[model samples]
Target chain A: MIGMTLILKKINQLIVGLIFLYGIYIITHGHLTPGGCFAVGAVIAGAFFLLVLAYGSDILKLRKREEGSSVAESTGIFIFLVLAFTALIIVTRIFFTNYLPKGITGELISSGVIPLYNIAVGIEVAAALFNTFLALYL
Target chain B: MELLLSIILGLMILGAIYALFARDLMSALISCGIVGYGLVICFLLLQAPDLAIVQIVVETITLLIMIAVVLDSSREELKEKKAAEVKLSHFRKWYVMNVILIIVCLVVLLYFFKEVTSTLDPLGKHLTRMSTAYIEYAAEKTGSANLVTGVLFDFRGYDTLGEATILFTAVIGVLTILRVKGKK
Candidate 1:
C-alpha cells in the first residue's frame, strides 16, 4: 500500500508539471493562436480536477482551498486595477489609458500590457475554476 | 432557405417544449443550456463574436451555479406542505396567461431580430478591407498580431478595466454568498 501511494504521488507530480507547462504555453501563444487565458486556465483546472478525482478530497485538503481561492481572487482583481490605474495616472494622463509602449508584433515577449493582462486573467481563471471544483468536491 | 429556417424554428419550439416539460430539474437545466447554445449560434450568425463569447461565458457560469444549487437543494428532504387546490377555470386561465406571455415574447424577439439584421453594420466589409493593416499598424504602434488584445488591453484599456470591475463584482458576490461563519 505504501509503495502504491508513492507511485501515485510520483504520477501526480508528473501530471501537475505537464499541466503547468501547457498552461504557460497557452498563455504565451495566446496572441498567435485561438487559445488564450481562459482556455488555458480551464485546461489547468481540468488537470487539478483529475488529480483530485484520483487522490480524493483528502489530497486537496493540503491546499485549504477557501483561503487560497480568496487570496487569488482578490489579488487578481488588485493586479487588474493597479495596471489600469497606473496607465491612466502616468502615460495618457487619462484614467485607464493604454500608456505602455507597443514593443513589437509577433514576438514572444511582445504586447506589453496584453501579455500582462493575459497572465492576470490566466491566474484569475485557474484559481476561480479550481475554487469552484474544490467547493463542489468538498 | 425556407427549409433551413423551418428546421431551426422547429428545433427551437421543440427545445422549449422539452424545457417546459422535463421531469427532472437537471434535465430542465440542460434544456435551458440548449436554448442558450441556440442563442449563441444566432449571435454568431449575426456576426457578433464578442457578444457570443460573453453570452457563452455567462451561460457556462450560470449553468455551473444552477447545477450546484440543484445538487445542494436536492440533498435536503423537505416536508410536503398542503397544497391549495385550484378550480378548473382558474387553472385554464393561468395556462392561458403563460401561453400568451410566451407568444408575446417570441413575437417581440422575432421583430427585434428582423430589425437588427435589416440594419446590419458593414463590419465584415470593414474587417476584410482594414483588419490586416490595422493589425500591422497596431502591432507597430502598440507592439501587439493580437490586434484584438492590443485594442482590448491598451488602446481601449478602460473597457478592459470595466470588464475587470465586473468580474470583481462577481467575485465579491460569490464570496458574500458562500462565506459561512464558524466553518473554518
Candidate 2:
C-alpha cells in the first residue's frame, strides 16, 4: 500500500486526463509538432505513473497492470515491424518507404507512414517505461 | 541570444564549481545535472531542438537511475567516513591544501580549453552532407513538417527501430529479473 494524501489524489485526477489527451495530441501531430514518438511515449508513461502513484497499493493489481503493459508493449513493437515490412513487401521492396500517399503536410491526417509509426512507438514506449517503473519500484 | 548563452555558460560553470565544494554525493550529483540542463537550454537556443529533446530525456532518465543507485549504495559509506574523521582540527589544514590544489588544476584546465577552442570552426557554419540533405529535402521527402521527426522516422528509421527494440528488450529483462515469485 503506497500513496500520499487527498491533495495528491485530487491533483492527479485532474491532471492525468489532460496528460493523456496531450500525449495523444503530441503523437498524432508528431509530423508538425516539436514532439514525436519518444516524447509522446514518455509523456504518456508519466501520466500513468502519476495515476498509479496516487492510488493505494495492491500487489495483485500491480501485477495485473504489469502484465497488461507487457502485452501492449509487445503488440506495439510487432505492429511497428509489421508496418515496416509491409512497405517492403507490397511496394518498391523498400524497408521504410512511404507506400501510403502522403497527404497534405501540416494537416491532422497527413504524413504518410509517420503518424502510424508515432502511434505504435507511443504505445511501446509508454508501456515499456511504465512496466520498468513498476518492476523497479515494487 | 549571446547574453543568454553566456549566462547559461556561467551557470554551468558555477554548478561545476559548486560540485567541487558539495559536502554530499547527492548534492554533487544534482549540481552535475544542473550543468547538463544548462546544456539543454543551450541546445534549444541554438536551434537544435532535436538535440535538446534527446539531451533532456537522457539527462532525466540517467539522473533517476543514478539517484536510485546512490540511495541504495551510499548508506554505509558515510558510516565508514565518520569513523575516519576523528579530529576536525586536523582536517581543516588539509582542506585548505585541497582547495589550493583544485584551484591550480582548474586554472590549468581553463588555459588548455582556451587554446583548444581558438582553433575550432565557428558556430553554425559547419554542416555535414547528411544534415544538409535533411535540412533541404527532409520535409519534402518525408512529408513531415517537423524536420526532426522527419529525420527520425523517415531517413534514419532503422535507428529508431533499433532504439525501440532495445528499450523493449531492456524492459523485458527488468521484468524477468525482478519477478517476485518464480519457478525454481
Clashes of each: 2, 0
True lDDT of residue B179, candidate 1? 48
lDDT of each prediction vs. the true structure?
A: 0.67, 0.82
Best by lDDT: 2
Number of the predicted model whose DockQ against the real structure is largest:
2
Candidate 1, residue B83: lDDT = 37
Tens digits of per-residue lDDT, candidate 2, A1-138, equal 477689998998899899799888888888897878887788788777677667744633774534788888999999999999999998779898878888887788877988899899989998998888777766
lDDT of 1 by residue, A13-39 (tens): 788778778778877876654455666
The residue-by-residue lDDT of candidate 2 on B42-129, one tens digit each, is 9999997767765786677667756766876782324455555766657786998988999999999999999987987677876478
What stretches of model 1 exceed 4 Å from their correct place? A1-22, A38-43, A62-66, A85-101, A132-137, B1-13, B36-91, B94-139, B182-184
Note the chain A TM-score of all models in turn: 0.81, 0.91
Q: Per-residue lDDT tens digits of candidate 1, residues B55-172?
A: 6655675676677678657733343444324455567779978899999999999999999878776534553645666655776666767566667666666676676567656756
Q: What is the lDDT of residue B175 in candidate 2?
A: 80
